[model samples]
Target: MSSILTNTSAMVALQTLKGINASLSSTQNEISTGKSVATAKDNSAVWAISKVMEADVNGFKAISNSLSLGESTVSVGRQASETVTDLLTDIKGKIVAAQESNVDRDKIQTDINALRDQITSVVGAAQFNGLNLIEGTDDVNVLSSLDRKNDGSVSASHITVSRQDLTSGAGTFGSTGLTAAAYGTVNGATASDFTSDAAGKVAEITFGVASLAANDTYEVSIDGTTLSYTAAGTETAADLASHFVGQINALGLEGISATDEGAGVINLVNTKGYETVAVTLNSTSDANLEITDLNGGGAPTDGDVGTIEQRASTIDFSTTAGVNEGDSFKVTAGGSSFNYIAGRGETMEDVAKGLKTAIDSNQPDGITTRVQQDATTGQWKLAVDDANGDGTSTTFSLAVSAGGTASGGLFGLDNIDVTTNEGAAAALDNIETMIQTSIDAAAQFGSVQGRIETQSTFISNLTDALKTGIGSMVDADMEEASAKLQALQVQQQLGVQSLSIANQAPQSILSLFR
Candidate 1:
């Protein structure tokens, strides 16, 4: 027990001093770096979670930038559309003035034409970086996404913002028949004067045309009312006069006349005057239809004149019958079959285009598409019309396929989708809707962007708080560590001194033994 190797006091004191030195160094590191877990060795769990959150924050920043770009593009388009609307309103005012007979009719007409031309110019020039929303050019997609709920329900933010061009300048009203008809004149005066009764009834005029010039003007009269119009160069007898009457009849105006060859009696329909009247006609060899009884009397009643009313545009869309997302619905029209997967991004446009191309291409079925925007429901519904080549225009509703979600919808806007089964017809309607939808969606995004920005700032601060929390749990207290280190150093020195004295005593015991 008295041997030098058995001096445990000194060994313990040296070990204690080494422990104090390690504590001092640790405290100094924490003080200098201000972080207890700067490395994985400090606290792996907190560091990992914080790193993941940081990555998310970075991703959010990138998304914010993308949203910003999309917002600006949509904003530009909305501004252009609004500006063009103002111009259209101004044109409407000019048209109203042109309706007034007391106004300088010719001057008003000229002004209207000029205003129309100006509107055209405005629509043509309303473009942002070469994208014209008013002139009916390109479409814009606002980048948006939808979120799915745990119950399998899906909701979404409009990721794609599309701008619709409504500038009537595209001149795409195609193939709607609107040509004039051939006229039959019996002859008697300048091509412009027509025979009429005292009540302004159109008199009978029949002419045998031996190849009239393309722009020749013909005037036929009954009593004295002259019915004058231009003739096409190709006008011939094979062409039925009734074919011409059909259109004019639809205009609520008297447009034709006839005579009984056997009775030498003339029957007429009047349009320019208040009451229908009749007059006698005397055929002259002047190559033009001539008439006498000039202004004596006899006008046709309203019953004698036919009326014409324009039917609504025939449009249709294609969709499956009562199918959900898991089910497949196939619509074959215009020679092609468009299939829809329930709950997927099956747009009315996609369905409409198939029918339009099919019908126009004459694929046995005269299929067309019409889409409607129900401003009341805010649902973009797809309706397919007339299953096959049948002349019936029927409508059926379609929704997102099962497992499919809706996105890019306008906030507070109802029925934004084209609801017609006819493609071109749907386009005409949607061209207006797509615009309003985008505007509403953009405004919604603006509100959301503001909210997200606020949340981002809050999240940033929360992250700092979390870091502070983890630091509180494990970080070294520098002031306390420093004080403890000093105390421990003093204790180690005293222990060393005590151990040395004890060793000396043991040596003295050995001297006594000697």
Candidate 2:
């Protein structure tokens, strides 16, 4: 069947070798590249998806950086607030000295002025990268994006760091008055134990004071009662004792009397069975002085006056002469009677703090008020805190106008003062409520910052996951591709070999004729 004209066997062998060579080359290419689909023609859909996911990952990296920046900004604001709190504490000491009569009131006033200036400087300088939350003029907004629905409805998340604007200005003070009020009770147990015998009563309240110079007057409010006395002659242990007993009986109360134990020590006896009543001392002196705690033990020392060993609710105004529009004041507020100050060098935001001090000072134990500012109007308004805690609370208007009134500063409400037309206690309550509002807002920023950080981290992780998924769907498998290419080359070679064999059959007919 073979003919010289056609070498079909050789042709088949040549085709087979070509096929094997092609298979080996394909396999070698797959091994060298390590990918089955190296181009878009291999798998277009998967490649597109992977590209999209990678873009998202890049975006997320940028978002993570933004979150870090936002966190730093908020941290700076928090530090400023903390610093202000410390300055307020130092100011409180100077105010207490104003109550003294013989201690050079002018000098004390000068010291107070200096301290106020220092506070202003601190607040003004407390800044980071041109952002200052305390000295006013700064608004911080942390940017974030959220996908609310599956349809790609995205919403922006914002965290605002309000400025504690302590700047002083005129006509900025808002009226803060209340509808209900309550007074604090001064417990007498700490002063001296009271005793009563057949002689009716003996008062045990002894005030340990530094040298009480001439022309000094002392006022004692016991169990919500007011008793006043003036030092007629030079201050001695005997005269102070006699005055204490006389004032005790003058109240027309039973079972309460006074006794002078020795040297500046006095003991109060409760002839009655009530243990809740106590004596409070308020000094009317022109000298820079201090008031010791009513229950303060031992003889009064040079530094003991106005020494706050324990806290009481009653507010003692260092500037008792009353304040004008510009004068600042300091007082205590809240359940713990946390001390704070208002007036001069204080911004509208800090004024809210003054309001809280006024409220807490009015009552030893009373309802706590919470305050808030209207963003549009900038007014600090008050409401009851934990309305269910004690006695029915009422709404009070601290703002001059309801809507569209320039009431509060960026920090909170400014120039706000509590009024007693509502009630003395209510006035104080309103003040406290305003301060709480500002504090609550500051807290809100902290929460927002935390949420932003969490979201940023989530987005970062989600982007990475998306990239991995996309890669799995589209990335080429080089080993599998190489094997398929080898198989295809073998099929092509076999076809050629079969065609060659068929051609040889025709040649076989020529051989038959021979």
Best by lDDT: 2
lDDT of 2 by residue, 285-357 (tens): 6333323343344344343122222122122112112222233222222222222323323444444445553
Worst 10 residues of 1 by lDDT: 180-189
lDDT of each: 0.40, 0.47
Tell me the deviation in Å of residue 238 in model 1: 40
Which candidate wins on TM-score?
2
Model 1 spans > 4 angstroms off: 68-81, 101-158, 164-514
Give TM per candidate.
0.40, 0.43
Q: What is the C-alpha RMSD of each candidate to the true structure, in Å?
A: 19.1, 16.7
Instruction: Tell me the lDDT of candidate 1.
Output: 0.40
Name the lDDT value of residue 260 in candidate 1.
38
List the lowest-lDDT window of 10 residues for candidate 2. 189-198
Tell me how far the alpha carbon of residue 107 in candidate 1 is from the true structure, in angstroms, after superposition: 7.1
